[model samples]
Target: MKRIILASAFLSCASLSITSTAAPMDFDFSGTFTNDNDVVLLDFSVASDSTVTIFSSSWLSPDEGNGFDPILAIWDSSGNLIEEQDDGEVVGSTESNGVTYNHGTWDSYFTQFLVAGSYQASITQYDNFAVSTSLADGFERNGNPNFTFDENFGGATQALFNGVWDDSDPRTGAWEFHILNVDTASGPGPAPAPVPAPATLALFGLGLAGLGWRNRSKKA
Candidate 1:
């Protein structure tokens, strides 16, 4: 009886240690647009209920001649547009989420809670001088003439195309971007698999040994 109780206690400790060591999901990437309508695509997967945050600080103000004004768009695997953001600092902008980015001349940040799934994201230049989706129009520049995709933009695989716009114009600089996933506890989805610590593994082994001893004692 005491051996059985000891086994249960060790199991409890192992479980606690494993859960406490799990890490959040995050990714950071940097790329550049060589022309006015350059676009870059990134793919990521979420294993549980998570808040996906995408942001960039590589934009330049209008005063900077070669500065880039970035636009970000996210889509599901089926090509449906989920969300898009142009300016993170715009007051009362729903896409901004009231978060300010101070990395460069301009700020761009976006956040959304998503269920477990695969998603695609696009980052492109937002040229005020170009004919593109207006802020009031929700930045719907996916099919617009100013912005075009490569032949494999939304194909079966993830791709990054250089200067793929139909027009000759392209954004003339490089850009840096980041995507992060923050797991939440309120959803009915499965949690991410925990990474067991060495101590947790030791406790787990102790539990198995205790159970083996208990079984032998009962047999005797």
Candidate 2:
């Protein structure tokens, strides 16, 4: 009788652990921005310590100039910028009318290790670089073609975009993004496991002792 109870207790503990585990998460997103000045922010959470990858390389090969150049940025739950990426592995090019347009593809990517917590991912177009370390600091480029640049690098739109100094091309603001290795709960950390009560813990010990005695008896 005692042996059966111990075996049942062991099975119960194992079952509890298995049932409490969270489902894995991987996501792909596609959307368009309202206009050149638009930005897309995604909010997600990981249940435990894990790695996250953001990618936007779709606008490279077949259709180069169809979409805007993508810039990806990750922000911690505390609204601090972790890192940002302007372009990916491949450069972009397209030919329209008669002129051959040469520029980076609509690609941006990054893989980062993050603690269990909530985070934000922001996507902007070319010349719209994230300006500060804080998420609230905003991007460098607004809709205006002629404007003062960032204070750190201030001038008449002080950026040499697509081989043109202090200039940028008109973009449709189309975009896509992917996120991998996240918890299904979309939380900052792993699903919280329920703590066993004192009585349950005592049972665990008793059950282990009983199981061990039965094993010894069988061996003998």
Winner by lDDT: 2
Residue 55, candidate 1: C-alpha displacement in angstroms: 0.3
**CA lDDT, every model vs. true structure:** 0.39, 0.45
lDDT (Cα) of model 2: 0.45
Q: Which stretches of candidate 2 lie over 4 Å from their true place?
A: 1-21, 61-65, 90-106, 143-171, 184-220
lDDT of 1 at 144: 41
CA lDDT, candidate 1, residue 68:
53
What is the Cα-based lDDT of residue 181 in candidate 1? Answer: 58
For each of the candidates, the C-alpha root-mean-square deviation to the true structure, in angstroms, is 22.0, 22.4
